[model samples]
Target: MIVPTRSSFSALSCLMGRLFSVYAGYEQQDAHEFLLNFMDKLHEDLNRAPHRKGPPVPLPALVDEAASLNVRINHFWCQHVDRHLSVISDLFEGLLVSSLTCLVCRKSSSSFEVFSCLSLPIPANKGSVCYLQDCLKLFLETESMSGEAAWHCPSCRQKRKAEKRMIIARLPKILVIQFNRFRCETAWQSKKLQTYVQFPISGFDINCFVDREQVETQPRPAYRLYAFLNHYGTLATGHYIAYCRAGHGGQWYMYDDASVTEVTLSESDKRNAYILFYTSVDMRHQFSSHP
Candidate 1:
């Protein structure tokens, strides 16, 4: 869901109400049912008169609504409200296997973590980072943890320097990539990285980001861009907009506040992209076939 900066509660309510209206037409039973329940509660709450006029709802609060809805859906499903309501977890959840290697003994340890999004840091260079692959490569690159923060190796039984890296143990149907652009070194000062990152509209293969052993055995998943959230301006104050395609290989449109207009593939569209949304091509085909 997209809303303008400094938007009123009424504006947010209207946006969500319209979204639910569109979801009402979807044929997916599990998703439709879950959204219907959420929409009903939301409508009831929004319809109630406020005691007094207060500050406008922040963007982060609206973002948290998704998390709130997910929790509610999980509770309802686990309570046997629906046996087939695993769509949210199935589409967004994925596992990451993080490995740390001791530089001295070469002893390695690994752990699994669950994530719904992948946050990547833009590479620092004298020149601009030109491609999304460069950022992805930097994310998978090994870094040494030494000095005061050295890793304590159990095998070596001492504080030793270690190399750490993370690999995708499992891939999700919907992959959300967040660009780490905001940096805060001190309590008072914060900065936004304006590095231009080039990303592909389609055929983005993330096989290199996966564990080498897994990549050797399994087929690499091909992803196609579906939507992206962009932030314009600075870290302290910025406007959020989104560009999304209607269907697989469909035309793209820019969503700014309540206004939406068709946009062509161009460099201008990539300028402020903060979060990229990609879907597995295989999964898209499966969904289209089933639908």
Candidate 2:
């Protein structure tokens, strides 16, 4: 090592003094968190630099995240990073985020992957990519919010000749749910016609029954649609079904309707099962065989 002269040593000592002085002025707990975070980011950024900007990940292997995923540090770390410093804050935060990454089995540029939070909200900070775990935790209701399952290989998803497994996810904290049923009334359409349905959703063993009326006839068939209500209802894995014939009004069906006189889930969030809009009479008429 090269020994420094008195003036050089003095300057170095002054620099360290300034650093400790500033650090000491802040809350000790904050300082500790800051330091621990800094060291972790420092290690990650150093390690991640070598793995970036390579060829695309493989194909068949790439489809599985367990095999193709690898975390990359999106930013770097610095000892001088302070919350007040905008540039340093941005850089260090990115490094910290990417460090806790979940790699795919075989990830490529085209993988149907996005981020979600594990513990906090997506983007609780300045720069946030959703963490995968958080994405999985939330039940997919709307088509837009659904992830990879929302869409599948068009060719592969329709294979009914062999074994098939439908995946349903139960999300956390269902706050409110609603179910509505309407009886169609029309003279011309009223006849000896009944619509009976038995379809599976995320929860509840349900059978929707619609029967025509011989009473005051209207322009349409009299049909009774029983949209059962189920809250936190457990259901077998299957397809989601829905249908509308001209003037029919309906809402979602929840469990806890039959035995309970008044089933009200005022302070509950609904957990949705994963299934696209599916409708077919054959699937509904098989309730007897299904146990």
Candidate 3:
């Protein structure tokens, strides 16, 4: 049996349990098997002894490594082991369509990529109260890549200035938003952005960030906040804890290292939020109906 040694692993396990509970299509046995496989792989990869002592490793890197392993393990099980369990990918992965339009020729090109998380950049402006909507706006904002960084337009047949933007092509059952608070300009220089970003605890409408055509065709999807990862302290040294709500009872709990405590909704929604997790409201109802 795999044991949780770190807060990140425990938090992830809790989030996965929430996901499995909300999606009745996934079998408990299969989910348990997947978790075991993920933990085993993560332990093996992270426990490799080095030849000599080196600089201290960052916690974020280890968390990211564990997450990547989870994704890979989920993909392998869904694709190679059992195709019916592909709901794992459907719950988290979504398609993002990026468009690059040439300013001179007025021609546009588009590409689609699947994304598991949205990493939003924090503005450099200091002492400004920020909101999640502002970060979403910044993410979708069109930017003109001019000068040497200009894109090669096929129609213009030259390096020309282009405007690039990204929009959601497909929506997933679970949406994960990552606020990039860590900044590192050089190897030795690193800092954390302590900007206050306000996010809705429930009824977060994502239609505005999606493609216009998608909004017109499908019903507007609203999400309810269920879990979030919080980071405390500076960039070089910090701790990661998670706040999650029970799928059935709607009670919030905080997971810190080996301790778990019940917390109020107000307590769960804090400025230290680093990774936010939301689930589609409609799917929640659909799965709750199942025994």
CA RMSD per model (angstroms): 13.2, 27.2, 13.8
lDDT of 2 by residue, 104-136 (tens): 211112122111111211222222233222332
lDDT of 2 at 266: 27
Instruction: Estimate candidate 3's alpha-carbon lDDT, on a 0 to 1 scale.
Output: 0.67
Residue by residue across 170-200, what tens digits does model 3's lDDT show? 6777788888887887999987888878899
After superposing candidate 1 on the true structure, give the runs of residues whose Cα lies further than 4 Å from its correct spot: 1-85, 214-217, 282-291
What's model 2's lDDT at 222?
Answer: 24
TM-score of 1: 0.68
* Segments in model 3 whose C-alpha atoms lie over 4 Å from true places: 1-85, 126-128, 213-217, 267-269, 282-291
Q: Tens digit of lDDT per residue, candidate 1, span 101-204?
A: 88999877665566667788887782565588988788888888899878899899999999888777567777878888888969998888888898988888
| lDDT (0 to 1) per candidate | 0.67, 0.25, 0.67
Descending-lDDT candidate ranking: 1, 3, 2
Residue 171 deviation, candidate 2, in Å?
A: 22
User: What's the CA RMSD of model 1 in angstroms?
Assistant: 13.2
